[model samples]
Target: MTEQRLRALVYGDVDLNLIDGSAIWAQSMVRALRAAGCRVTLVLKAPVRTGRLVDPLTELDGVLVRHPHAEGLVDGDAPMTVPQAHAVLGRVDGDHPHDLVVVRGRAIAAALAGDGAFRNRLWPYLTDVPQNLAGFTPEIHGDLRRIARAARTLLCQTEELRCFLEQTVPEACGKSVLFPPTVVVPPELADPAPRTANTPLRLVYTGKFALRWNTFEMTGLPTRLTNAGVPAELDMVGDKIHDERDDPDFADRMRRALESAPGVHWHGGHPREKAMAIAAGADIGLSWRAPELDASLELSTKVLEFGALGLPVLLNRTPMHETLLGEDYPLFAASEDDAVDALRRAAQNPDLYALAAARCRAAADGFTLERAAERLRAALAEVYPQPSVAVAGPPLKVVVCGHDLKFFTRLLQHLAALPGLDVRVDPWRTLSEHDEERSRELAAWADVVICEWCGPNALWYARHKKARQRLIVRLHRFELESGWPQKLDIDRVDQVVCVSPHYAALTAEATGWPTEKITVVPNWVDVAQLDRPKLPGARFHLGFIGAAPSRKRLDLAVDVVEELRRRDPRFTLFVKSKLPWEYWWIWKRPEERAHYEALFRRIAASPSLAEGVVFDGYGGDVAAWLRRVGFVLSTSDDESFHLAPAEGMASGAVPVVRNWPGADTIYDRRWIHRDAGEMADAIEVIVKGGRWDEERRIGQGQVRDGYGLPRVRDAWEEIVRGR
Candidate 1:
């Protein structure tokens, strides 16, 4: 077989051999490349006297250089007074020529690429480096900006980094490729099975000795596993390097936590292979990271390595794994109880572990060295694919306006993602008492004015303009519900778009405008590629997928679930909404927050609703939960489109919507029924019938065809272009 030809140089300021996450990261990438038949070369400014090569011993396999005087330095920039560091890097660039030299540190990487010779070959790879006021020194900022502009390519590990880079250096970020964290699993290394029913299960955590790594989550989990007659031992490996270790005072709380925790061993630090071998022997590896860290949103190398070693991995519910991996995995827990349950389940079901191992291997292959190389080469080849001709005219400058800040912000993101289209969003979500001044200022600068629920402001802009460029006003549920017309000057406005025909009808009725003047552009939920996994025996589960108290009517949902439970003791209600756990102070009083907590507990405890009422927590994955239920219910008092039911219907759930005032008097009556009673009846009927799944499948097809993104995008384009 022919060898896959590619070269990678892993250079950074941190000691590559240090027993830490950074060293593990450097090792994984290098090992992955070597396994894929790539000509791998690594460069590090190691300590002058005892410069030892890091894990995988790739230094010996490839090329290793030692810097005599660069020891004990955190930075490699000579301009910053570290002369030996710069000398070492300069020497590496001259002697060992390669296809790509991957630099990790921001400043040093930028400084290296600043040289014309290195600029053509250097690829700056950002490993989720946090940018804060403390770290934002003038030199660091300058080098980052330089690297952002000069490097032939930039690689980011997470979406957060991509979002951050776009804000910092948007133009340079356009050339960047998001190469998410991955693992390389050799067949021999990954053959070990997780602890089975006959033997004690071994649980492991191979990460830095920090609370942020969520060592605390593992505290009580081991107890649950042990109580279930599954002997569970939790072993924690990989402590902070000597210099990198924080003060003992930093872990004061952890010390207290360990006092009460049992069957948990905190091994300070160990060699790379030792840690990996220990991990390979474990049943499951914990990779629960604090969500606050933007870098943690990507799958950690620890999680990947565990999978590479063929251990069933346990993770918290995070975007980190979801975006890269699938929904069905061995374990995903948020709290201690959930951790216990997941642990016990994994311990009992060896087959589940085998399934997870298979998926993990598949995931590992998806992010192999060969795949990473292909992604890099493909991105580089297309960096500047367009010809350098200057005959094209200036790009269109578009300005979108909306009353609700969040609504406008989401719209802005959507517009920004559209390439070759110059778009600027004037977000007036924070309209002060002096909004008139602000609106006028923005009005003058805008070419195309998109007025969305901007009531008086929209009217003001309409009265001021003669529709020279374009003036569009979008009517939402609030505009119709409040009995307020779109409030735009019809003579000056070029287009009027209602989120739904019902909203448009309400506006037309109030304004005495012709129906022809208003265009119906329904809101859409993008579920083209959502995972709609069917849960076994999920027939009696009722799902409500929204957070707002008014729109969702949680109290009404509770009543409905109580009514259902009275009829069928097996019925369960799954309320999928994110709790304000981080911002509990907003509840005003302990009693108020406690009341909600009790409500959640009640739902979780009921045999019908307890395990059934999974607080699926905030975000777009509601589709997954929706598929597990026989019926989808929404008791919204009012809405423009009521996306929850629409989304639920799209996920193969039988939608039961309440008949609101807007639904009765709005445009058409295709979906909404009378009330929650009617919704409940519809759900009961679906449960009684064995055709609920088939019905929902047909409905899903209907939603995809009618209210999909492309359909909505087309309507939006027509409205904006005055077609």
Candidate 2:
């Protein structure tokens, strides 16, 4: 039987282009559901008038976008009435009903709650719970209770809101799911703006100037910071909307306040992308509001938006903010005076500001679109389970388990694109015996299970494998020395994959497993992603990637750089890695700690070695970084197909591999060196002998032919299918 595509219908009363909370929530939801392999149709009650117009039949990233009326609904208006919502739903759901119907606004939810057509398909996404609703009349409260009880799934933005809903309507407790708003950008684009001691502190605000937001107090922040002897500026990127019923002169009053404040630039209004761009270039984001009027038990989306742009936020000290940003976040404030002091301190102390900014960036990872999609997919899977059926050629269910997602994400992508394969990935960063239940679930769902590393995941599958399930475990260099190999039940596993024959032999001896069970499979590399032209002045530069732990022999790399700098001062060593001292586990080991400590001491004592070495911190742009590195050095004491040199070689960089236990099995013999002196001699030949370009071409050709993704995929398929 052919698989059916999952379909979802998202209904909202807000205009898609409006710069409001409802629009943001609706658009993000649509994008996330679409990314999770659902055919989504977004039905908006009003038309989009600002930015780009999303046509009624237009598709975006596989999502079918639609807006019913062009001018019937006003921008930034209240939610649509019951009759209007019914008309829109009737037009959209003509003949075939959607598998899932997600409504955003409370008014829309109330309208559809009693409709028998949407009985088990309705999912109400509540963005806000108004405090005034607690004192509602009996008739109105009954409507809310009915809506909450009738929803197939009640989605809340935060845990506090979820709890609040369960208290207000007890039946919702069982069906409620916490679904936070999300915004995701690539690392290269989301890089934080550089901060320096001399640079003026830039504070940004990007929301409506409602009186409840305490815009009046925010207008005076820049002046207050300046008076405190700190150079500061504020960039306000929104406009004040006038509501005659609430406050007739609020917009004029805000305009006058902005004019009176010095060093405050009022950038009236901007689209979402423009606003995020302005925020990304700034140093800080402001999210202050009056506590009495702030009904946000759920998190403020503005805080998350700024964090997604890599800016630390200065939000009020509320329960929601504390939960998301942590209790110890230094930028939390309760009053204008507190905010002023926080800004002053951040401006005066560069290190403090950098640390806080890093924390904010780290916090943003939890609310990424990818994570949001995972939640949605899990929820949908529970609601709509796939049917088990016999077919002519069923897709092979393959589950790839790993501790590091970075190593397996690309490989999973390759597997997912294959014709007759269904791949699922389960990544446990610090896998232990406690994760046995999760491992068992993943293993039971697979026809073939491949463990990326010979760690806890491999051991779990080895002990728990079903007779019908085919198990494969891949071992790298580190696993060969670890005690995990001896504990594995080799009888349960079908195959053990090694990157090189040398490691295959070592693994067989370590585990006492038959040699027939071991096989060599080269790691796949995306050659196209790495093949870039060399940057200017890259010929003399030497690069080392992954310098963690003491066994990497980074000191040997420095020795090679020290020798080369004697002949020519232009040669430099660029080391790309996370510093080993940052990890507590590595530093706690006495021998490992002393080895790195002494290595740093030697570098500190040598002027040439210290000056010639450049530490490039861990980053995602390896392909771009390799362009500036002419020679890639691998100075490890042992190895099982170290991929750094192969990746560098694909980028037209000459490989300089040190002779190790398995180096000969993977790399060409000519590139292998016995010691630092031999490595320096190879570098000298490449540079002084003018063989840089020739060696680069040869290395690139070798890696592309040997380790390309297509060749690796074919080999994996053959082993997995037992063909």
Candidate 3:
């Protein structure tokens, strides 16, 4: 890398020396640039005449030089006298001899307007202010147009912010880059005084409160925590908005609500430092950036600051937090009871809290001032590479196949993570029956196609198409074992990415496809946070998770329980199926229904072995239930990486799985049983040997180490980038 010094002129509402959003951005930006080995000069618009040479400049980590320029027209960093501002800009331009001129607002438009030489590489950092200001004046409109045309880069806070710019300033669409706000400095943090064994956990929330400041209604996490008596407090550090306080009708309603709330405190408007000071002593930090019409595109500095202070945060689930804290932090419920339960859970298990805190520290390491500077340096290098610059159009078009809402949504989320990829998914539902026009149009628009069509005729139609677009077809359980579709249809697919290598081989053998074209990308479940709760009593009970009637074979489960009952009547079955009645629904005719009903009625009525099976239907914590079950039995006839067995593996359950067509290989040894009789034998062996705990320990460790999302995401990134 070559050593290059870059000067930056930052004009915004808040001063870094002072406090607020603008300050955070400028301070962090300056620190980041300096760490990137660039000398930065921050230009601000405070009155220079009224005061003696007031040093508006404050150094951040000794890397950034903050200069407060005396701006006369607008007291704040807003549009001012065009030519006068230009004259000031010219003076700064001449004095600095900077490589890049950073313009944040219209106040410096004249300075940027005069000549192409000066305006050529203007990088304006927009903070979502352009869209919300009161009236749209001619000068404001003209200044925005000029900035859009003249600026080399428009650094936005979010994709939502970028999309807004695309719609409002159509011409500046290609130049926009999403850059969320970040912390410029690590706050002073200290470990809380050690609590007594019987002491309640201390939970704290510190931030602003108002219509735009806090999101009290949307996320009910705080409410849940308070109700559970987890010793929580929502500390409102800022004064409520004027409208909320002065308006009698609104103020009454607000006070009544706040007063009714038990564990919340309104500490009305403390100094920024004081608020942070109060936050430093808490065990758990609450950094929820309340959702606002304008702030959905916003990432708060609070969460980052909390992390820097070594406090594990319970954040609101937003795109901004999701991006920065990816697998580095934990999130909690937005309800009162949930928050309380979360605190209770944390208090009961210090290990979890400690792990979360460690992760928070790890996240802070990556989000430090130096790291941010590196990111800023890279962004600037991309925008102002060498001396020559040319704006490039959006790169690569990404077309996703299968328009089922869930699949497409997940696919879009993953694709969205990769920058510069234009993504669009064809709504597959409409084409499910047949629609030539829509299908061809979708194929025409896509540069690369991903289709899930299994029928041979459909693949043949796609094979004959004229387009040279690369095709990727994904196959899971339905396509692997279903007799409805023949294997010859797969020859039309260019490449196949299956959920499991076992299934891939099974499909290739069944379809008679060459092995080279098939790649196994195991069926991935988004187990983003799959850690199970510790329940000691979970060692005795046996369980099975899943609802498919024929595939799961509930009958086999009943038989296994009865057989186990013969050896030891204490062996209970905990069936974690979504629905018990759905087992009978699979039968079409009255005879089939009657047979299922008779068997179910007999099992329900029998006092001997039937009482041992308890059907605990759908639950929130499936993984936890898995922990509660000592032996996980999956007697399925067909499966594609059955989730129940996988979850069981995650939760330390000894998997008594059948040699189902697609899932037989998930076990450590060769599946010894293909039929229900064999499954009964396996269950009996597990119960008699009393080695379920050991099996569970080995299985959970294997899954946690190999099949978790981090490993899967790395695999996915490689596939997407063609690495």
Candidate 4:
């Protein structure tokens, strides 16, 4: 049977006629949600006009648009009046009831706060800081609190705002989700046009020229660049002023500045598409705003739009800008002079400008329509969870229970991508540590429960699972050696998954489970994220990851580095792991503590080993770390699937696996070595004979083709489906 599509209603006090930020947001959001399989209905507070040249409703595909009217409610106001609430409620109740109702304005949020009927359906999208609400009354605050308490989710524009709301309104702590402004690039500007050396540095500003945005500096920017000996031009693609009712003289002041400034063209108020087209040809984008207003916590839609067009933005140096673009980003402007200097630098070196533009484009990916849709879908799923069982042609409900989320997060992502599967995670930090009720709830919600490790989580589900639910437990090398496997209910579990065939055989022997129940499923790796350009001196650098237990054989890694140092002094071993003493559990074992201490002492005593080894403490940036590593060394005594080598291989690094029990089964025998001497010989031959590149390519290809997310996901799908 076909499943029912989700229904969503997005309403706000936004003007559709004006081609402004709010209009762009409404259009993009409606389109994005529609694209994510949602039947969206957009309700605007203002009345629909027929006199306009283009209808906004016609532009937004698959979205039903409505304009509901109230007698006394103004466009932007707090504490919604009684008539306003009645008008909105009447419209919703008069029509088909929506599964989700997204209120964009605070007034609208207030209007619906008291309605218990819309509580579960309400999702308040607070664009700005609630603290910044103008004419903030005690009544409005009460309404906000009520709305926060009632709404299923409170959507925030930025993480800063989310954190602020969580702190200020503690009631909204676990119910907020970040829904940043997204950029939708047209096909023409999808891929950035490369800027040439001789092209004049064309800077484009495409938003309201308000005083708050520092329109005065924008007008004089072109002249400043020219004075700095850089051939530049500025294109201002927006109105001369904004909020003219409050500041009537601001437009005239801006016009006077623009008229006086040379090499500045004011093409005011074009359609968003036309403006973006103009922006697409520009070398750089400008987003210099007044810091005193302190709206830095809010993400600038202008920056994201510019990035979507693949142009590097010349933004103000603020915490928000630093968060979006890195601190070391070349185009940050503190003053008008700083902006000029940045433009001059970019104009002088086209290569530097290209690099900066590329970085901006890459950063923009996180705020694209697709990414926003994914986040929205995930958020909605949590609010309105799918049922565990279907009425007919049952869809699979998979519950992934795990102790460590490091490996299982990737697997969960893959499982979520599969068709006809409703997957959820039940993570416990340790075997014994878990919410018993939550674990049982998750187990009850599943057709198949997969325990990531054969630990307490596995046993917990085995004892608590429903009669109809199938249980599958995975056993890594360490789990087989541990006593937990013996305690597991072998009769309750339908199958056992192992990382490799060797581990599968060993697990069956250890647990005395039927051989027919054991199967192999390799670990999934994100090949796309790992496939990055290797650093310049990476070829000579050997890397070791995860040196926690004494069994990892850090001493063996030292021996390999020492042997490599004899051939070439440039060879260095970069250990990307935590020191043994850093883990409190490792220090509890006297023998393990003594072994690690003795190894550290030996390294300190030996000048060659100490000089050759560089210990980079535990880091979350494995992709960045792997770029500096040319060879990934797995010197473990035993591993079901040592992911470090596979990750390294995906990052264009060759794998040098020490022949543990399951190492040969997971990795190619050509890369696996019998001992430290053979490992050194293999490294020497590969590096000296120029076979490193070939080996790197082969290893990377193997990982991408074999252990990639798609292949691993397919394997899990097949096993769960009883194929």
lDDT of 4 by residue, 231-326 (tens): 788888865266567678887888877666787887867767788989998889998776664555577788888987889988787766666677
Listed per model in order, the count of residue pairs whose N, CA or C atoms clash below 3 Å is: 2, 0, 19, 0
Report the C-alpha lDDT of model 1 over 506-583, residue by residue, as the tens digit.
Answer: 778878776777887777655442324455556777787774543456656776777777777677777777664544
| RMSD to true structure for each model, in Å | 12.4, 15.8, 14.4, 8.8
lDDT of 1 at 295: 36
- The whole-model C-alpha lDDT of candidate 4 against the native structure comes to 0.78
- What TM-score quantifies how close candidate 1 is to the native fold? 0.52
RMSD of 1: 12.4
Report, for every candidate in turn, its global Cα lDDT versus the true structure: 0.62, 0.78, 0.57, 0.78
Residue-level lDDT of model 3, residues 1-723, one tens digit each, is 123455665445432333445555655666556677666666554443211112323524434333323334234544335454555556666765666666554455434754676764677776534544344476766666677787766776655555555545544544565455555432344443443355545555554344444335313445565456554455444444325643445545555545555555655544445656666666677654433432355556676666666677776555445555653344554444444555667766777777766666566665566666666676665543331112246555656656344433434445544444566665555424445576677667765666554543236345644455666666666654555236345555567777776788887778777888787765444332233433445655778776446546777878877876777777788887665345455556565565558667878787855678887756444543454577677776777777666666665666677776656455565333666667666666665688666666787776666666445555654554444
The global Cα lDDT (0 to 1) of model 3 is 0.57
Model 2 lDDT on a 0 to 1 scale: 0.78
lDDT of 2 at 69: 59
**Candidate maximizing TM-score:** 4
